[model samples]
Target: MDLHYTDAQNAFRQEVRTWLAGNVPAKRLPSFDTEEGFEAHRAWERKLKEGNWGMVTWPKEYGGRGCDLIEWLIFEEEYFAANAPGRVSQNGIFLLGPTLMEYGTDAQKARYLPAMASGDEIWAQAWSEPGAGSDMAAIRTKAVREGDTYVINGQKIWSSRAVFADWCFGLFRTDPDSARHKGLSMILLPLNSPGVTIRPIAQLDGDPGFAEIFFDDVRVPSENLLGPEHGGWGVAMATAGFERGLMLRSPARFQRTAEKLLALYRENEDTASPATRAAVTQAWMDAQAYCYSTYMTASKLMNGGAVGPETSCNKVFWSELDRAMHRAALSLSGAAAELDAPWLDGYMFSLAGPIYAGANEIQRNIVAERVLGMPRG
Candidate 1:
């Protein structure tokens, strides 16, 4: 892979940099978990839509600039460098948007993509249930078909952004007798539908970063079914690949964190222990390694390679790298780490890295069985 960007790519970077410098908020926005913060972030999304920077890789008709993955990486790099507001519509634009493009029909794409890109509809992920956390095949949520609709009944816990999201996409058991990974369908439903209840689940920061959703015979049109009925396991897995792989956790995010960690080390270099210094160096190197690896993956994807079990390796690396970077930052900060809001909050959030987007343990299992061709224990 070429280490240097083409002239056009450099120009694109400058364009993004200029726009962000002019439009990014002068002050950081609040967390999107709160009502005020949520709307603030929504407004930010709308602003991005107006600039046609919402989802750069999407087609123009879907409110995007029609760029490729490499360009998308450039946008992310600039986005983090600008310190822009967190994307409140990440569930829709990053995870579901790609899934819809692949699995959705023309009509489905026409109906959802534009709205998702414009932030007219924010989406939540409703995959984890009380019984099925990492073991998604253990899902008990039922969606019984009746004429033109599917009657949904079950509960999903730890649903990210459900508290303020407009819609959700999840896998439900379509076949009553089906067990494990079989007989499932990915379904999209509005959060405001009758019999849909959302109870906020507060994080350690006392914000509703996630929620528990209860569906009591909620009826949704059969058109809301994402892919082929009873073939949703594959559709859901594609979305998980996005979550665990490239889109959700961009390499630029960790790069920025690593940059901050290095700066923190330099500030206290005189007092920093040898282990602390070593950790900081390791974090920076890991961040660069992730960035380069993602570039290679992107190039392969552009060349028609697909995201596969190898994404599990990417997931494990970036997630653990995020945690390690934060830990090093805290070590550098010493007692002040508790009072340092950014590092403190980041450290707390990093703790969830291994748990969400399919637990690191589950990801390792995928790597062993699927990528490494190891037999199941």
Candidate 2:
């Protein structure tokens, strides 16, 4: 792989660095899981949109600067470096927006993409029903077609950001005769629909970072459907690819964490155990490896190659690396790590890295079965 950044890439990095230096909030916003914090994050997203920096890979008509994937990666590097407010609109901008771009109708694109870019309609994911957490094939939510609308009825649990989101997208069974991965359709619906109910679930810190959603014969316009009916399994997998493989966890995030880990180690090396120092060194190396892996993936995509099994490998690598990095930071922090600081917050959030996108066990299975060509039991 080419290790050198082109002159244009360097110039773009400087541009992003300069803009972020000027624009990032001086004080950190509250956690976006809270009501006030949610609005605060949305405002930050709007500020990013105004700067034409929200999801830079999006087309220009969608309020982006039409940057390529590498530029998006560079932007992410600068963003986390600035200690910018966390992306409250990520469920839309990172996960659903890419899916919509691939499978949405012209009208759907015009309707959702711009609002998503502007953070006017923040989105939550409505996957992981009571039965189908990792086994998406087990999803029981159904959306029955009724003329110009689909009447949806089911329960969705562990929906991230649902407590405050304006909309959601997920795979619902439209064909009663079908089960497992088959006969599913991807649908988008407003959170305030007449027959919908939302109950928030608190995180370790008591913030409602997730919610449970109940659909009681909720009706969404048939036009809201994305991709082919009964073919949503593929569409959802495509979305999963983006989630597990790309946007949900970016390399810059881990790189920043690694830098913090090194700084922590340097400050506490006198008292830190020998093992902790070794782990810190390993974390930095892993972060660099992840950054390179992601760069290779971006290069492939930029050159018209699809992200496949290797991205699953990337997911496993970075997620575990994030947890390890946080562990090292916590160890370096000694007793102070117990306090409510960035290290504590990051450590808590890192605990979920292996679970989000998809559970690491399942991802390892994918690596074994798909990448290594090992036979499945």
Candidate 3:
């Protein structure tokens, strides 16, 4: 139950803080309102890569610092604090990286990991077909195996960043006979492959972060297969576990956000309404809980303990907390929370927190059944 960081960890935090102070550019924060903001984020990601601070937790063999998880957490804190940029390669870095580390061939790792680590190749997740959504086992995209290649043909909806990314990794039906979770295979495909088309899905915030991808006889090299054929379900679950769980946003990041919200609250003497006060207080408490939860998780990971359903709970908690905080901010701002409002855009964008990274409801189910030992429906 030790929640305190060691002296060495504090030093690591200072080091990250110093580097970010010098390197973080003075750019306006990104807005979900326009494509320009998204491009700015990508540019910032390139800057981070050039600075050699991207993917700090990955092994040095993959162009990372190979730092411990605590150091990674510290770095994330500083990154968010600097308001640097939202991760443009998050799906690739968080979901696919660990999966490749676990199941990819040496050549596959050599081919993809370095470029991904360096942010030279951004990636998107090609999961969640229109019919699939939460029931990922129901994905209908088919990949028929040909000699030395797999010709893929299907439409993937809600494929985040596919419109701008270079690669996508996901499950495809390699065996027509396979039903439910069986007969699926995890494959990596280049987004620029012939016959592939991407159409953006405009969100309420007016950003095209999600896109629909059509694979019309698109062919990928057979060498891109990860793990065993018909064994993609396991690989996908592992990838999702990392994606929806711990690797993307760490606790310190949440702590910094919460602190910012608290500062906002403190600066407003008009936020004296009982409800607003209570909401702000609750947000602060939730932020601390998120920090503690991440601390425990980082400790466990450092001790060689694997992340399981517990990370699902953390994801749900922190994401919902973020939404709550932003909601409170809107409430505090009252009439200024509408479109063209000062706080309107950010508050609206925060609304998507619960929906991304495996919707909060699904995370709750994972926590209830897999982590809490509750019986399934």
Candidate 4:
């Protein structure tokens, strides 16, 4: 693998770096889980839209620069390196947007893509449930079609950004007689619609980053369904590929965190243990490995190759790396760790990384069965 960047890619990298240096906020915005923070992040998204950097890999007609996957990777490097505020619209830009590009009707794309790009409609993912968080094939949420409308009735839990989001996309059992991943429909729902209720669930940070959403006869136009009705498993898988593949957990994020952890150790080496130092070095190396692997994946994707189940491996590796890196930081904090240290908060969040994207145990099984051709017992 020729891992070298071409002159053009290098130019794109410089462009991204220069723009981020000039535009990233001097002070970080508030956490996007709060009401005030939601609006602040929206404003920031608009700022990115104004600069045509909202989602660079998107087609130019959709308010992006039409950059390729490599350029997109470069953009991510600059984005995290600058310590920019977290993306409040990532669900829209990273997950749902790609699915729409692949399966949405032209009318659906025209209606939602631009608004999503501008952060006029921040999106939440309503994929998990109390009973089916890891086993999404067992989702029980139902949406029944009547004439031109679909009435939804069920519940979704662990919905990221549901508290302050304008829209959500999820799978519903459109054909109740069907079982497992079959007979489901991917539907986009307006959060403020009647019969819809959102209850935010507080995280360790005491912020409602996730929510439990209930739908009671919640109705939307049947036109909102993505892909074919009862044929949504394909669409859902494509979206999951994007989520587990690269967009949600880019290498740049871990690299930035690893760098910050090292800086903390350097400033207090007298207080740091040799084991902590070794762990820090390991974390940095792991992050670099992720970046290189992602680079290879991007290259393959750019060349028209498909992403497959192997992405589960990437998810497990990065999530564990995240936990180890944060744990080391908290260890260094010592007594200060109890006083609301930043590392403490990060450590708490990292604990969920293994669980949120698909429990690491499930991922290991997938790697065993699908990637290694192991048989399920």
Candidate 5:
């Protein structure tokens, strides 16, 4: 409940702020604004690696700084506040790396972790399909075992970053006869494997960030299976926990965005009306609430409390707030909204926030049933 930062924590933030001041490149600030912007992000990630700031919470054996969760949050806050480019290896660093740390073999960690930290390999999530947009348990991509390898055959649509990624991490149907969530298996597939085809899908931002991956008898080693084969639903749940919570957009991270949104509003208030001011104030308040919620979550983790289904609440809140803030920004732009106003692209990109990671509607259902103890649909 106590949200105060210790003197040491304050010192850590100052250290991170100083490092970012010297290291973050000004021109690369907008690289996170589009799919193409990842190229600049990759270069910036290299700069972070040189300082051992890549995935600071990982074990030191895997090239991380072995820092605490609070330290990592401080670093994230300052990193975003500096307007540094997004991490080019986000899929690898945030999603896959944590999944591997929890469920992967030692060999798997050794093979991928260092390379991921150094930006030598990029990964994408292969989830969501034409038919399984929100009901991820309904994904139909099948992986049939044959001798020493699994022959994966099916289509995965909306696979973010897959168009240019070198690897894919996702769940597949290892046992087609099993119904619902059973028989699912989390697997890894190299993009260069034979019979795999990738088709990029354009977004509102005019970037091919999402892709459709068609696996036609693609062969992958059975060793790529994460955890127990049929127990992948549990593994995937753990993965989703990270996706929505600290692993993706940490609380300190959102605070940084809130700071920028405040600055933007203050600078342009001369053109904003009373209604705009009210909306901007609401956005700022919501962002502050997000920070408080994240702090509670962090305290729970630090105290060895498990992050359960409740993390979905944070995901729904922040993702929607992000969309709202961007929408307000676009409205403030008036006729310039469509003219590549920096905030316009932000507005367009925010539209995808509720849809990706897991739609807000789906998250509400989860909170109702699990958190609120309500009846199911």
Candidate 6:
């Protein structure tokens, strides 16, 4: 893979850098977990759409620049460098958007992509249930077909962004007689529908970053079904690939964090021990490695290779790297770490990185069994 950027790519980087410099908020917006913060972030999404930076890799018909994955990486680097506001519609744009592009009907694309790009409607993931988190095939939510509509009845827990999101996409049991991964379907539904109840689930910071959703005979049109009926296992796996792979956690994010970590280490260099210095250096190296790996993956994808179980390896590496970097930052801060809100908050959030997007343990299993051709026993 070529490490050098072309003249056009350099120009694209300059364009992104210039736009972010002029448009990023001078002060950071509030945490998006709050109602006010949610709206504020939504407005930011609109601004990104106006700039045609909402999801650059998406086709132009969906409010994007029709850029490739490499350009998307460049945009992300400039965005995080500008310290731009977090994407409140990430659940839609990152996880669901790519899935829609791959599996959604033309009508579904026309109905959802524009609104999703503009943040007119925010989406939440409703995949995890009380009994099904990492083992998503164990889902029990039922969606009984009723002529032109589906009557959904079940519960989903730890649904990120559901408390204030306008819509959700999830897996449900379309055939009650079928067991495990079979007879399941993916469905999209409006959160405000009657019989749908959302109860906020507070994080350690006391913010409602997640929610428990109860569906009591909630009805949605048959058109809301994504992909083929009872064929959602494959569809959901595709979505999970996006979540665990490139879109959900871009390398630029970790690279930026690593930059901050090096800065933090410098601030304490006089007191830093050899071990601390080594840890900091290792973190920076890991970040660079991840960035290069991602570029390789993007290049392969551009050549028509598909994202597959190997993303599980990427998931485990980045999540652990994030946690390690944050932990180093906290250690450097010493007693003042708790008082440093940004680092503290980041550290807390990083703890969940290994768990979400499928647990690191499960990811390791995929890597061992699928990527390495190891036995499953």
What lDDT tens digits, residue by residue, belong to model 3 across residues 243-352? 66678767666677677767777777565477777888898888877776776777888898988877787777877887787787777665666647535665666677
**Alpha carbon lDDT of each predicted model:** 0.93, 0.90, 0.81, 0.91, 0.83, 0.93
Q: Write the per-residue lDDT of candidate 6 for residues 1-377, one digit (tens) a residue.
A: 57899999999999999999989999889999999999999999999989988889889998888999999999999999999999999999998899999999999998999899999999999999999998998999999999989999999999999999999999999998999999999999999999999999999889999999999989999999999999999999999898888889899999999999999999999987888789899999999999998999899999999888998988899999999999999889889987948999999999999999889999999999999999987
The candidate 1 region of ten consecutive residues with least summed lDDT is: 331-340
Winner of 1 and 2 under lDDT: 1
Number of clashing residue pairs, candidate 2: 0
TM-score of each model, paired residue for residue = 0.99, 0.98, 0.94, 0.98, 0.95, 0.99
Per-candidate RMSD, Å: 0.9, 1.1, 1.9, 1.1, 1.8, 0.9
User: Candidate 4 residues 1-377, lDDT tens each?
Assistant: 68788999999889888888899999878889898999999999998888888989988888778898888988999999988878899999999999999999999988989999999999999998889977899999999989999999999999999999999999999998999989999999899999999999998899999999999999999999999999888899889889889888889999999999999999889978899999999999999999999999999999999999999999899999999999888888888888876688789889999998679998899999999999999
Error of 2 at 92 (Å): 1.0
| Candidate 2: tens digits of C-alpha lDDT, residues 69-106 | 89889999988898988899998999899999999988
Ranked candidates (lDDT, high to low)? 6, 1, 4, 2, 5, 3
167-224: candidate 1 lDDT, tens digit per residue? 9999999999999999999999999999999999999889999999999999999999
Query: CA shift at 316, candidate 3, in angstroms?
Result: 2.0
Model 6 regions more than 4 Å off: none
Instruction: Report the lDDT of model 3 for residue 235.
Output: 94
Per-residue lDDT, model 6, residue 36, is: 92
Worst 10 residues of 6 by lDDT: 332-341
**lDDT preference between candidates 3 and 4, better one:** 4
Off by over 4 Å in 3: 1-4, 29-35
